[model samples]
Target chain A: MPDAGPPGRRPRAAPAGRAASLRRQLFFWLLPVAGVALFVSALADYLVARDAASQAHDQGLLDAATTYAERVQLSPQGVPRDMPAVAQRMLLAEPDDRVFFRLVDANGIVAAGGAGLPDDLPDGSAEAPAFFDLGEGQQRLRGVAMRFEAGGRPFRLAVATTTRKRDRLMAEVLLGMAVPEALVFMMTGLLLAFGIRRGLAPIAPLRREIARRSHSDLDPLDMAPVPEEIRPVVAEINDLFARLDRALRAQRDFVADAAHQLRTPVAGLLAQVEAAERAAAARPLGAAELAGVAATARRLSRLVAQLLALARAEPGAPLPMEDLDLAEVVREGAEEWLPRAFAHDVDIQFDLARTPLTGSRIALREMLANLVDNAMRHGGPGGRIRIGCHPADGEARIVVEDAGPGIAPGDRERVLERFCRLPGAHPDGSGLGLAIVRAVVARHGGDIRLGESALGGLAVDIRLPAPAP
Target chain B: MRDARLLLIEDDQALADGLSRSLRQDGCQVAAAVTAAEAKALVGSRAFDVIVLDLGLPDGDGREVLAHLQQLGKDTPVLVLSARDGLDERVGLLDLGADDYVVKPAAVDEIRARVRAMLRRRRARTGQTVTLGRLTLDPQARRAYVDAEPLTLTARELAALEFLAARADRIVTKDDLLAGLYGGDRDVSENAVEKLISRIRARVEPAGVQLRVVRGLGYYLQTGDA
Candidate 1:
C-alpha cells in the first residue's frame, strides 16, 4: 500500500454555518441599500406633507385679503375702511379659528401677525407662508405666514391652527408607509434564514451516512436525492470507494492463492516419508541403500521447511508491525549463522547501521535470514560474505554480498521465482531460498536488486521505507 | 532387558508401518495408531514407555493428544514428529507437554535418537550429571565438566552442548539448531553464532572433548578419542 500523505497535519476546515454567514454577507450589501432608500422616502414624505399644509392655509388667507380689498372704497390714501369688520369676518368664519392680517404702506412694516415672525421683512422678497409649533409641550399651535402686494402696498397675512391636527395627519401617513416596509424586511430575513439552512441540511446526513459505514464497505453514497450542486462531490466519493474496494479484493485474492499453492508440497513430503519408511521395513537395507533413503528423506524435509518459510515471506503473509532496531537485528542474525559460514571456510563480515525500521521484525529478520542463507548456499565454499545496512533514499538499506560465483545478468530475475534454482546448484536445497527473500522484501514494500558484488559474487540490496513520524 | 513400548501415532499407514518396523528393530515394542483418536484409545488401553506423535491427522490435531495427556497428568514421555516446521507450531507442541519434537522428512535414526533421549531422560530419576565418554553435563545444575575439569560456558552454549550430546552423531542443520535455541525469532546471524561456537570450543577443546564442525551442515559433539 502507498503511504498516505503525512497524517494528523490535515488542513483546517472552513466555516459551515450558513444563516449567520449569509446574514453577514447580506448585511454588508443590503444595509446601505435599505438605509439610502429609507432616507430618500422619509425626506420626500415630509416635503410633500409640509408643502400641502402651507398651500391650504395660504388659500384661506388670500380669500380674506380679496374680500377686504373689495370692501375698501380706496379712500384717497389707499387704507382699509372697516378693517376690524373684515378681520373679524375672516378669522371667525366657519369655526372660531385664529387669523391675523396687516396692511402696510410702501414703507416696510409688520405684515403678518403670526407669532415668531421677523420684525423687518426684506424688500422685494417673496416669502410663502410656512408652518411651525409655537409652545413647548402643551397648548402648542401650528400656523402659516403669507406675503403679497395688495393695493400697491407691501402687506402680509398669516393663519394659525393647533399642531394636534397637523401631527395626527403626518403620523397616519408615515405609519401607513414605514410599518409595512419594516414588516416585509423582517419576514424576508426569516425566510432567507430558513431557506439557507434547508439547502445545507443534506450535508449532515451525507456526513452521518459516511461515518456509519464499515471500514470494508467502500460503496458510494446514493446521489439521486441530493441537491444538484452536491452531485459532483458524491460522485467523486463513490469513485474513490470503487477503487479502494478493488484494491482490497485483489490483495485478499493474492493471499488466498499463495496459501493454497504452498500447501501441496508439504502434503507430498508427508507421503514420501511414509513410503521411505515402508521401503526400509520390507527388506534388509545395505549401508549405501540406507544412506540413499535417509538422504532423500532429508531433502524432502528441507524442501517442505523452505516452502513454509517462503510462504511466510510473501507479501500476502499477515505481518505484524512494530518498531525494530536494524543494527540489533543484523548483528543478531549474523551471529546466529556464523558457525555454518566458518564450517565452509567462508569469512562473514558485518557493518550494520543503527537505524530503526517501522515494520514486522519477524518478516524483516526472515528476509535477512533467507538472503544470508542464499549467499552461503550458492557462493562456493570458502568464499567471503559481507553484510551491511545504512540509510538510503529516506529508507534503510540492507546489502549482502558473497565472493562465490556470481549469477549471470540474464538469470538474476528468474532466481526470484518459486522453485527456480540455478543449474549445478547444491543438491540439498529446495530452490526457494532466494524466492523467499524476494517475497519478504516485497511484503515490506522494499525493493531488492541483484548484481555483481565486490567479492565477485551476487549482491542483494534491499530498501524499505522509513518509520512514520 | 526392559521392553521399550513406543506408541506411534501417524495418519499415513505406509509411514506408520515403516516407522514401526524401525522402532521394532531397535528393540521397542511398537503400538501403531493412525490418528489421535486411535492413539488416545490405545493409550488408555495400554501403557507405553514413549509416544511418537504426528501433528496432522484426518480426524484432529496431534496437539489434542498432548493437551489430553497433560490434563490426565500422564508423564509417559512423548516425542512429536510432524511435517510442519513452522516456528509457532514447534513451540506449541513442546509447550503442550510433549517431551521432544522433530519435523518430518526425518531419518529413521534421528527419530530413534529422539525416542531414546526421551526414554533416557525418563529413566534418569535423580536428574544428575550424565557422563558419556569424556563429555559430562548436568542439565539441572546448569554446568559442564569436560575431562574432569570444570568449565564456564554461556547459557546458550551449555544448552547447545546439551542438545548436541543428547542426539550425537546426527547431522543437525543451522535451521534445526536455531529452532531448538531461539524459537521466538530466527534473525540470528551466522557469524555471531560462529563466535559463540569458537568461544565454546576454546573452553571445552582445551581438555579432551571434541566438537567437530560438519561442513555445510551443523556441529557434532564427539566425546570419544577423536
Candidate 2:
C-alpha cells in the first residue's frame, strides 16, 4: 500500500536550481574582509609614522630658531643692533620651504620679520620651545616660538615653516609600509580565491554525475571521489534516492501486478467477444450466448474498475487529507452501492454514528465501496449485509458483516493480497476487493480484522485513528 | 484539420494498442508513440488535433513533452494519462499546460470520449444548434425544445440528452454516456448515469425523441417517428 508514498507525504528530496557553490560564496565573503583589514592596518601605520616624522621636523625648526636668535645683537634698549642675512640664510637651509622668523620684545612688536602673522599668537609658557600647527589647509605650516634672554629683555623668537617636507615624508612612510602589504594582501586574495575554486572542484563532477544521469537512474552515487565534507551530503542524498527508489519500485510493481491481473480478464473478454462475433456470423447469436458474453464483459468492467480503485487507494500513495465524517462516507457509500446490492438480492443495514476521522475522502470511500462490493458478491442470494460505523475511544470503527460463507480463520490474511481469493469464493470476485480494502486501511493508519459474524457469516472489522484536534 | 488526428503517447503497449483501436472505431485517426523520444519526434514533426499523453514514460517524465509543446507555443490540447494516484501530480500536470488528466487503468471508452470532447472544443462554433426530428437542443446554451415548445430540464438531464443526441440513431453504450456525461476522469458509478438517463427519457418522451435500451449493449437515441 505504500506505493504512492504514505498517503499525502512524499520523501523530501532537495530541489533543483539551488545548487550550492561554496567557491563563489567563500570568495564573496572573504575578499571584502581582507580588504577592510588591510586598509585599517595601513591607516594605523600611516598615522604612527607621520607622528614620528613631524617631531623630527619640529626639532629642526627649534634648533634653527635658537641659533638665529643667538646671532641677533640687541642694544640694552631690547632692540636688534644688527640683522645679518647670512645667519638667516644658514637657518633657512632648506630653500624649498617658505620660512619666517620674528624676534619681538615683551611688548609684542615684530623686530626683524614679517608682521602679517597673527598678533594674538600665544606667548608660549616659559619652559621649552613650543611647537604648534598653524593654518592647515592649502599652505600647511608648523611654528616653534620660544623666549630667549637676548639684550637682557625676554625676547620671543618664533620660527614658522611650510610643512612641505613633513607631508612628503608622511606619504613616503605610508607608501613604503602599506604598498608591500597591499600587494601581499592582494596576492593572498588571489591564492584564497584559487584555493576555494580548487577545493570545490569535486563538486563539478558531482554535478555532472547527477546531471548526466538518466531521469530514472536511482542508483547510489559512487562515493570514492567525493570530497570528505560533501560526501556526507551525498550519502544523505543517495539515501533519500534509495527510499524514493523503493517507493517507485513498489509503485512499478503495483502497476505490473495490476497489468498481470488484468491480462487474464482482458484476454477472456476478447476471446468471448470474438467467439460471439464468429457465432453471430454463422448464425444469429442466441440469447443464452449473448447473456454469457455480456456476463464476462460486465465482469471485465468490474475488474478494471476495482483495479483502478486499488491503485488509487495504494497504501503508499499520498492522497491529500481532509476532515470528514466516517459516518457520512459510509452513508454515501451505502447509497452508491445500494443498486448493486439490490441486483445481487442482498439486504443491507446501516448503523452509523457521527464518527469523524482525518483521511482522504476518496480513499476511504473506495475502501468502503470495495467492502460493500465484496459483501454483495460473496453474500449470495437472500443474504443480509450489515454496515456499522462509530467512534470508540479515539478511534473510528467500521464493521461490515454478511450472512454468506465466512472466510476461514487461517485464510483471512492471505485473502488481503492482490488477486487473492478463497478456493470456494464467489466466481465473480476479482480478488482486488479485499486487497484494496487493506491498502486503504493501511493508508489511513487503521487496522483491519476479520472475524466470525454474529449474522452467521463473515464479519470485517476496521479501526482508524482520529486526527488530533 | 479535415478529421481529428490524435497522438497516443503511452509506455504501455497494450493500453496504447487498446486505446488506439477503440479511438479508431470512434472515427479518429490515432498515431501511437511508445516512448518519450518517439512521442517528441511525432509531436515536432506533425500537428495533431489532440494529444493523449501518459506521464510515466520510459525515457522521461511526459511533462517534458508538455513543456516542449508549451515552449513551441503550440496550443494543441493534451490529455495526460497518469498512473500516479497523487493529487499533486494531477494538479501540477494540469498547471503545466495539460488541458486535462486521467488516472491510469481508465476505461477505453472514457479516454475516447475525452479525446472527442477535446477535438470538439478545438472546432467549436458559437451559436450552433443540433436537431433530430422535433427535438432541437443547443448544447452550449443548455437549452432544448420540442416542436417549438420549450422543455425545461436539470443540467445533468440536459447534458445526457446532448450526448445521446450527438450520436443519434446509433447505439451509445452506458460507458460512453457516462464518459460523455461526467467527463473522462470523474469517478461516478454506473447507477448514477442509469438513473440520469431514465429521468431524461421521461422528460424527452413527450418531446418525440425516443431513448431505447438494448439489452447487454446500451441505449439508442432516435426519433419516435423512426
- Which candidate ranks first by lDDT, i.e. highest? 2
Docking class of 1: incorrect
C-alpha lDDT (0 to 100) for residue B221 of candidate 1:
57
Query: Per-residue lDDT of A307-348 in model 2, one digit per residue for the tens?
Result: 777777776555798788997777545534554454466777
For candidate 1, the iRMS in Å is 8.3
- lDDT (Cα, tens digit) per residue for candidate 1, span A1-469: 5543342443335656533564457555665666567668776977798778656654655556555544544456654443555655764364434444444445554332334433443222234344444554435544444455556665544444444445565677777768776776666566656665676777778867876666776877988777888889889989999988887886676456555644655455556556657767987645765565556556666665666666666545666676777766775454345546655766677776677888766566667777888888878687778888887767988889988788899999998887676898876666677877888778778888999898889999888887853
Q: Which consecutive 10 residues in model 1 chain A have the weakest lDDT in total? A: A117-126
Model 1 residue A252 CA deviation (Å) reads 8.7
What is candidate 2's lDDT per residue for B54-136, written digit by digit as tens? 98899999999999898888888999988775655765787889976666666675566556555544443223465555777
Clashing pairs in 2: A1-A315, A1-A316, A2-A316, A3-A316, A4-A316, A4-A317, A5-A316, A8-A318
Interface RMSD of each: 8.3, 11.8
